[model samples]
Target: MSALNTSVLRPAGFILMGFPGIEHLQHWLSIPFTVLYITALVGNSTIILVVKFEQHLHTPMYVFLSMLAFVDIGLCTAVLPKILEILWLNSKDISFEGCFIQMFFIYMFVTLESSILVMMAYDRYVAICNPLRYTTILSKTLVCKAFVAFFIRDLVLTGLIPTLASRLPYCSSVCISHCYCDHMAVAKLACTNIIMNNYYGLFVALSILGVDAIFVGFSYIMIFRAVLKLGSKGARLKALNTCGSHLFVIMYFYIISLFNYLVYRFGKDVPVHVHVVFGVLYLLIPPVLNPMVYAVRTKEIRHAFLRHFLPRKIDSDLSHR
Candidate 1:
């Protein structure tokens, strides 16, 4: 028995069927996807560079934004290049190892983003709820510690999902209906029952996302209470303004993620193309939008971007005009 090959059979690889129903439109679809990918890359890279070089913006909030931009870059880069390859070059084969690697990074970046958002909420809570101690509380050392803690938490939690999925005996078809190695999409191909994997994925997802949502919502509630207690209307508005962008980002992210989760779980009748497109967007949209949201809503980022990127002559011309 020891000499009888005991290892389970694994698929040679997975074929990423990108937008299965719309094969004719894939060439056209690649145009928009390419634009979004490029935009996400440039926008996030700009945010990171601006924050790093601009000393005036070296506060806790900007630091967290920079971290978010970095993660956003990773999140999109993990999936888009392969997606573009499938769309543009008709290359769709992802090695088993490559698929697992992509799955791990996708989960890691997502969970890490959740933790960072919580940290951002906490940062706002401190800024609004306890202004005097903001500097002392979120000091350089503590920020470093928070990043490490978030990274470790996500590493352990997100790492388990792909690890569990990878262990399944995938002795069946290897065609993944979606563009990337989505957790459930891959799980469904296992010849064995995936009830535990299904529930575990849900549990871990809810634990990270659900818990993050509740905490962020609570922090905002506390922030509002503090804002109301302020003596000046200007102070109240300023506090609310500070939180508006972060809150919008949270709502946008959660809404799409929760919808996608629900559809995957319950929307059996939902068209595969619809689900796939949303899945792609769920991962892609945030990276493309986060920097735009911050730049549009936050004056410091806007001014800094103009200062660094806009031509001096044009800036002076605009000012003069």
Candidate 2:
């Protein structure tokens, strides 16, 4: 199988659905992403390093943060280089196998990430709502259990689902308009009658994405109930304060996910670039932004940043002075 590009929509179709903005970007868009990526790299790498070095951050929340940063690193590494390479060289020529591999890891990391967030919510809920029982609730045993659950679920979603999906035989154009191996992209290229394929695709999507959404929602529901009962408004605010980064990450992921599904189903005539642009943002932003948001929001991370980076910056400033 090989990748090829053909317009999925004719002019009449274009008029109805309009263009999806995946491939469309101003020259300036790359500049911000460049800065954001460097920020992401530094931000996430620092989180990893701090967690590894600091005895104080050995708690469950920081452990989850560490895993989340690692996942972010994996996610960015998977997508960013290809994106930068393609943008600079104008080469989006991903091979059939290479595309599938990309999809597998991206899928794996995304699922893993969702699970990590769930673990973090549980960690925070225990910390805020059950201060005395927090250690018992989120013990070392329990954290390891959570990690096992994360990877097990991750494997099922990314590996099992894609394995079955790939076996169906790709009989269409191999050129995945977007960067990675999306199920819909491969499904569209399948040579076989794809009714069964589509069914499986939707089924798997609903299972992984659907189930994770439910868990995160449930965790927050419990958290909110606990928050509402706090006598002090300040206490309630403090409880929610930890959720800020997580909420941002979840909102970012789900909105893009819903947009992608909606565009694919309803906006068939949208331009390839439109789809490319949004998908690229969706894939890259959370991984990069998550560390920055979390670090900025929390004292521990802020202190870590200052302890780690500020001294270097200060030294440079003094050198110039």
Candidate 3:
């Protein structure tokens, strides 16, 4: 039936195979996926709300954190709900235009999140290496300008991906093997030669992840040097401690991302479901863990979270008692 329908230059829609080999287990999969989605939603929302309300947390670091949380929420919302619908409702069809829209938001938020992490690393570097001038260097104007610049960069670079992919005539099977509208997965569905799309997509991924990773690593190296030069062991410990959450989040983001990228592109002998599961995880895990890591590790965020969620009397009692 699908082969007969392939005569059309562009199909009406595409079927998102939630997990290609384990279709029978989609119901079971949705259980954990729902939990993750809800966790990400609540966790990132709490970060944004806490940072917005806590006047003392309005520094460049926390401001960047809130930006990250916002990106996380956007990234999750872009595809997770569609995934849930596919898994639970068995509604796997996505219109041609809708798929590109999902691709756009996913890439946009992912890029923004990467750039924000770089900014956050720079924020940490300024705070630790040049404390006296931290405020002056990372001024509101500077931060705003940096964010705007990267945001525009994300828009230009990521927008081209979907735009170019869309131009390709998807006359082949309109079944996407993965959960959501992954750029490469969708590009593979096109009947035309997709080498350009493949190369450009790989280029974009490397540019965002590779360059950002290098800058972040360099920033930390400089930070470590500055920390070692501090007068006391306690000061050095405290300085490194401040970066613990950010470092964890960065490692978590990059390691999983790099592994998933390699497995998807190179691990041809790997199972399709494994690729799909990792792809889902690639988007899901960060949003779920980022706020939890920060909440557990950052004192200011923890306190503000308690003050907001716990009742006044209970918060006071917990703090005192």
Pairs that collide, model 1: none
Better of 1 and 3 by TM-score: 3
Off by over 4 Å in 2: 1-28, 241-245, 261-271, 311-321
> What is the number of residue pairs that collide in model 1?
0
Candidate 2: minimum summed lDDT over ten consecutive residues — where?
Answer: 9-18
TM-scores, all candidates, are: 0.91, 0.82, 0.92
lDDT of 3 by residue, 1-321 (tens): 766655476788899988999989999989999999999999999999999999999999899989889999998999899999998899999998999999999889888988999998998889888899998999999999999999999999999999999888877699999999988888888888988887888788788887898899899889888988999999889877766666877877877676666675678899988888888887899999888876657889988888888768666787897
lDDT of each: 0.87, 0.69, 0.87
- Scored by lDDT, model 2 comes in at 0.69
Rank order (by TM-score, best first)? 3, 1, 2
Query: Could you tell me the lDDT of residue 109 within candidate 2?
Result: 81
Clashes of each: 0, 19, 0
Q: What lDDT is obtained when candidate 1 is compared to the true structure?
A: 0.87
